[model samples]
Target: MTLLRGLVLLSLCLASGQSAGDQPAPAGSQNAPCPLLSVNDPVQRDRLLYHTCYLSQPTDLGDWRQITPAQLPAQLKWQASNGEQLAFPRSQLEYWIRLNLKNDGPTPGFWYLALDYAPVDYVSFTLHRANGSSVIETGDQRPFDARGIDYRYYLVPISLNAGEAATLYLRLSSQGALNLPLSLLTPDELVAQSNTLTLTHGLFYGALIIFALFNLLLFISSGTRYYFFNAFYMASLGLFLFAMGGFAYQHLWPGSPWLANTAVPLSMALCALAINLFGRSFLQVRRQSPLTSRLMTAQTGIACGLLVLALALPYNHAIAIITVAALALICSLFFIGVIRWRQGHSHAKWYVLSWSLMVLGTLTYALAAFGYIPDFLQQEMIMQSAIGGQVLLLNYAIVQRWRDMQKRLWLAENRAKMRLEREVAERTTQLQDAMRDLEAANQRLEALSTRDSLTGLHNRRYLDGRLTELIREAHRHLRPLALVVLDADHFKRINDHYGHAVGDLCLRHIADELKHAVHRPQDVVARFGGEEFALLLPDTDLAGAQRVTNQFLQRLASCPAGQREGLHIPLTLSAGVALLQADETQAQLFERADSALYRAKAGGRNQLVVAGNTPAPVGTATNRNRE
Candidate 1:
């Protein structure tokens, strides 16, 4: 089925090309780019002919699982490949490498296949024998311990029988740069190259560690957020390099195949986030350039979002996001440097120099990743050098910033000394003015604290304190005091219908009604909460409070909805009246009144219920007209 699908796909590609009238291969296509690499004839101890194999990649992102060896012949005729490390434009395509190898040597031994572009996520190599059979497997995708040899990339052994002529088919897929720099090496040669690569990696890792530690200590000593961000950025960069260069797979996380797969994009995403923060803080982007500052903030958010996507999405999707974000971040940094440079930031010159190198190396590496160029340019090395320069330049920038701050502080001190006498006289006047203002503000605050701003009635705090004093006087004199608790019925309807402005006006209208209903100067009215109001009538009996409540309700009904736009929308409220009992505490009296209030609401609104009393006469309590 796989072979059949491959054949169908190949046929479809050719038919579409013809249908579109795509130009055909130029006249008598020249000889194959390079003869199939002969394994039997060793080219040199460490050097050999770089065979340019035939190549084909899926045109779509759909499954290429149907590709099989039976379709190998179809791809063999497609085209010849050229270059030590071929690059392709950014694509989510799967590629096939076709080559022929003859063991022209005397004996057969193990041959190691290596891929220099270590970040390529998955690779497959199949050795076809004279029989219809073949040996097929994959690289990089497999666990490090599972590889034929314990090396990064695809280190598989190809056991070619003496005098055997075998065809090799390799499949490559990745979310990162798509570079295919294939090398067939004897065991000794492979080890030698791996060791040389390891040494170079050690130097890079060592420098990263030093930078991270130095910045961390600098942050600790100076208490600056900038150094911490710088340290984190360097650490993330180290991890990214390790993941990309395959060192993380070999050493740090060999057991975590998931981490090995996700580490590059994750670390790079984090590195972008940290580096952006470091740049913002180092240059004071917010204070220096407000518009650019917002752009920087947005890019940082994007990098952070990509970090999550990297861990969750497939490598192909994650890589595409990381690549775009990476490009945007680099551009954003370059823009910041340019803005600061225009503003005459002294350290911005070195900052620009640093970012220029970094940008060049990043673009070159990214271009190769997308298959726009060959991989021989040592992009990884160039990026490493550029980043190192940036760290140094940023350190210098930090020092310069410190110096500038110190100079400003010194100038401020000198100005202070020159203004000492005048400042002392001014300070005396300010102190006298401050004392007068403080006294006036205290008086205003006292009024504000005691009164409700909305209704000009007593607030809850003032109500509680004043109620305590009134209760003490009532108990001491052996006199009666009545508590009237009024709750607006269906007040939410009023607010919902008329809006809160009129709702508040209606409340103030009720407050004024309570004040006008009072016959004695000692009657205190206060807004309880929301649309509820409370009244304390000292030296009053239940009958006297009952009469006052009737008067208050009548006044309330007369001014409905506070005459909004000259229209009176009426609202009703229920009330409970409780006359203080002998030795009753303030809380006990409040509870009795509250219970009566609920009973009034339960019976019907616009009515008053008296604790220890049946109710006001039916017509008197329940006869208020509803709006």
Candidate 2:
């Protein structure tokens, strides 16, 4: 590198007609004939002009000297060549590039010199005329308004009459590669080129703004975190590009030299932060792979550390750190995306593609800054183009992921609805089965409450309730109703001679006989009390009730109670009948029937008696029906 730099300086000296070991040339040497960089080509007005100029730098720290207006006229020494380009390694020493220009022509009107490279930190351009010298100084290290020309790049207005001559000198020093490309432009060329550059940068920044707004809309509409991170990354990249290109120094932070100096490195650090955040979220690293996710997190932490260092370190040091962090971010994101793609992440393809473009662009930008790449419009616009492509690819990935998520959500909702329907159907079936069991159990309970346990006849409570309902119904329908109270004759004797079981058997037999005799579906036979049973006959009369009693007696005599061992358990019964009267209360009717029962028992057993009539046969019982 040292040899190459020596050779470059040697060529610069040879082109300037000065020997390497010669004494320093005096600056005020109008008598000496030096080459004049004349802008005679109207078509190539934007081209570099051959001129008399000198380039110098301080030998060491002890040789420090202020590059002011007083010292500049005498300080300029070696002249420049028209065909030679000034290219040098990065250095801290201030370089003074002096130009002795004379427009000794017939076609010139207004001429200007423009410095192409935008990254020079401190630059001062001076136009030395015969009257006196006037200086205009501007760079990233000074206020943007301090420039002789109000433009983005370094521009100095040179007024030279058609046959007049003037000396122009420029001082430059930076922590950047010293690649000076000058254009001696006429009025037309200056206006046209300046407008072109402005329009290009305007459109570039416009596209970047559009991308940011698009991502913002996406984030708002879909509520996805990745879109937000991607938007932030685009914004940071835009700022970094703007600052690095010196537009920030000219337009954005004109009054803040410190801010202008730090903007590029700070924005670069911020870009790293955006990339890490965007990569981790876009790839879903946390959910895809824990190990890779942890790695990404570490890289993200490193990027944050770079930002902190950016605040503390100088521009040159911080920019280096930020550049390395940007590289690390690219590698980490690419690796994570590849891993996720292999592990079945569908969006990883687009993520990887986007990062690849950005990586290429970043590499190109870094190389161009180090003078490794030839400076051209394409080289200057490389990062812009690549970043635009990245924005498109990343947006597509976001849309794809959103669509996939929508599909999954729709499927989940449908499945949940179907599952709910199935559960409802199952629950309904279970309820139906339970209802059937409950109905059967309720029927058994009804029987237990109203039936006689020994004979399965309606019990006393049922007899009372049913008889009342029957009486009311019969009354409403203007029909007949009757009740017969029956008792097992010689029931006590049977119990004493045989056993209580035999007496029970006798009662059951009489109950069955009475039940069978009734025949009417609406009629009911219920056990009134011990040895007594009541038969309720709905829509029946006195004659019908009597026939039922006769039939019951025959049934009892035919089928004795039951055959016990080798003997027959015989059972005989007497009954009392009561016909309902609309005017008579239940007690009056029951009392008359009970009185008739007493008369029948008093006469003889195995006979029936009609209430308020002759005592043919009767039985003792309280009429449970109380209608």
Candidate 3:
């Protein structure tokens, strides 16, 4: 690489008539004669025209035929170039560069003269050899096919016979910065360099397109305004870079020179507008400071106006205006990001960092264009690198914003759930109280339905129910059950002599005595009707039934039946008992007991009779039980 660089420097020194050991001529030398560039060695395939001479003209000079080499020496004064490239600020003047070539070898030379810059408006190449003169004109101002060689940059072929010399003149005109980095190469070197450049540009543009599509998908799914604006910004930045780098002119609108020229300024304006919108939304500028928000709005409006004027104004004027507007937009976005970050906006720190990178790159490129700074790096490469970094940072900021939102939503849901639980607990307590009160009322109704109101004992209905249940138990478990039916003896006579009220009192007195005799919890005592009573006993045999009736008769004989208002009324009861037999139904058992009671009443006033047995005197039953 060092040897190659030395060779390049030697060739440049030879073009200015200086050897490797000699000092370079001064920059003010305009009258020195230009040296003949010798293509003598076939091994030396590449050369750079670093020390070319140039003549400036204010307007179009009629034709190339009017400026032959013989007349040009007296008609114009050519100035020597100071560096490898010829750089000038944007201008309307035309520049003419001169190179004198000679093939001093035995073989003829076939070489390509090329210009690396693409945005020059018009370039005309004129070659005058010993054989004939040729002229070729092509630039972004002309259709792409108008070029003699089909390539992105300006390239033309030149040939010189052995021992023959040629004079070549190039005319350049543009409405943008004029940078001429001219080179002469063999066919092999041209092809190699073109391939290298194509690969580099492909990777750069591919990265920009990927970022653009990725942000577009995010915007569609999330419906975030900032994401939409970010996608638009990336797309416009890519398009502007494409046009500025000549890719759009070569590939997109090669047939239309006007479109090629207009795309640069228009795309740049769109980029400015999109960035302003993205920054405003990402930072929530309106919520933070209304004044800053309005300023961004105005900047967007200016960018939109520039978009319309880019086609209407001259290319130089439109590009200049758009460049200034874009710089202002970037700076303002950076300023707003700083303000928001200081105010505690969560996403604004990333915004500030990203815009800071963009602002640095854009400022450097702009300063180079306006001739205020050296072009240390290629403007396109610097901007592309900065934009890639900014895109990644901003995407991260959006992700952080989404996470914050999700957290807030989760917190709100938890609070609502806690409130609902409190309400549910209160409702549950109220329902428990209501259920407790309902249970108490149901217990009272149950007591009224099953108990006799007058005797405070099981009524006839309860007796019937118990009788059926006890009969089922006796059949299933082989247990004895007894039922007794009894009637109040001489009850009608008491009512006739002492009044009905006294008779009721005597019946109650008889019921009290019967209740006291049957003290077992398994026994059920009930009033059968007026002046009649029944007893249901579970697990009781015939002998047990006889004993219970005898005891009740003995107790009643010792006590007065009824006493009211100092009047006494006598009462006696005749009872019959039946034991539950095998396979006995409730109706059959009740019929047998009623039959025994009827017999007891027929035999005498008061006696106990057992079903399937003869009647026994109440006194005899009591005495037999005692013995």
Candidate topping TM-score: 3
lDDT for model 1 comes to 0.71
Minimal lDDT window, size 10, model 3? 17-26
Q: Candidate 3: where is the Cα deviation over 4 Å?
A: 1-27, 40-49, 58-75, 369-377, 407-627
lDDT of 3 at 528: 64
Q: What's the lDDT for candidate 2? A: 0.71
Residue 596, candidate 2: Cα error in Å is 69
- Quote the positional error of residue 488 for candidate 2 in Å: 60
lDDT of 3 by residue, 169-248 (tens): 88777876676657788778788988887887888778778877888888899788888898898899888878777778
lDDT of 2 by residue, 421-476 (tens): 99988986786577668998656665556767798888988887887787677666
lDDT of each: 0.71, 0.71, 0.74
User: What local lDDT does model 2 show for residue 168?
Assistant: 77
On TM-score, the stronger of 1 and 3 is: 3
The root-mean-square deviation over C-alpha atoms between each candidate and the true structure, in angstroms, is 24.0, 24.2, 26.0
TM-score of each: 0.57, 0.59, 0.60
What digit string (tens of lDDT, one per residue) describes model 1 on residues 1-627? 332343343234322423211221112223455456677557631233245454545455355556666654443454454433455433345666666777777787668766676766567667777875554454456677765556666665677777887777777766444666667888888889779877877787898899899989999998999889989988988888778777789888777767887887788799889889988888888876788789889988888898899889987567656766675686668777877888877777676777776666666565555444454337667777777777777677777777877887999998998799689879867865775679887566655576787888888888888889988887777676789999998989889988998888888877777777775657788887888889988777767788878877877776676565785888778999997776777898899999999999999889999987342322232233211
